[model samples]
Target: MKINPPRQAQEWSYSSHQESIGEALSSPGIRSNKKTHINCGSSARMAGNVCANVDQIRRQGRWNNTTINDAYLTNLPRELVRSMAGFPTYCRFFYLARAILNPPTSLCKKLFPAIGE
Candidate 1:
């Protein structure tokens, strides 16, 4: 123990107001990329406690569930989703012939400078 010095104590933090998830979502600053602060009310709900904001450390809450698609997949094109109901037989054959004559592959590739490989 001689080699290791005693732990230095730091000042404690405390807060006394409560906040709701809706209130946080309503705040304009929060988007898919915005950082959020969540306070979990445990078995013992302490009074006057403050919600802490952890910047680098990751945390999630109710707002996470509100989105149908995961963040990574959200950026993908809408066409990636196939038609729920199949197209009419005649139309499908027509498109198939047209695709053979002029393939749509060229239309699918686009380069966005911001998102570089």
Candidate 2:
């Protein structure tokens, strides 16, 4: 089987919500509370929840705007593309190709590496 490489590296940035969560977590006096916040959900938590949705969408091929080709190959950064290309064909095809073709939202990318992979 022939394997094609991704054209570019997928780049994503942290949402404001995510930044807030990191700030909360990394704050000096904040206690480590494992419980999910009842009122204001943390950015990391929200991101994790959204990632689950993205994975479901990808596996089922249910994203409204996503095309088959989009799910197969992503436009990752040059460095990432090179790294992915070094992996086995099937891995590259499924991970890089599917990710690019599907192109997850920024939230999904931050929450789930698998979704962005």
Candidate 2: minimum summed lDDT over ten consecutive residues — where? 35-44
Model 1 lDDT per residue over 18-58, tens place: 22333454575544322222333220112111222221111
Candidate 1 at 109: error in angstroms? Answer: 20
**Candidate topping TM-score:** 2
Q: What local lDDT score does residue 10 receive in model 1, on the 0 to 100 scale? A: 44
Distance from true position, residue 112, model 1, in Å?
A: 22
Which regions of candidate 1 deviate over 4 angstroms? Answer: 1-64, 67-70, 75-95, 102-117
TM-scores, in order shown? 0.15, 0.18
Model 1, position 43: C-alpha lDDT score: 9
In candidate 2, which residue ranges exceed 4 Å CA deviation?
A: 1-25, 28-74, 77-84, 92-117
Query: How high is the lDDT of residue 54 in model 1?
Result: 23
* Model 1, residue 14: C-alpha shift (Å): 28
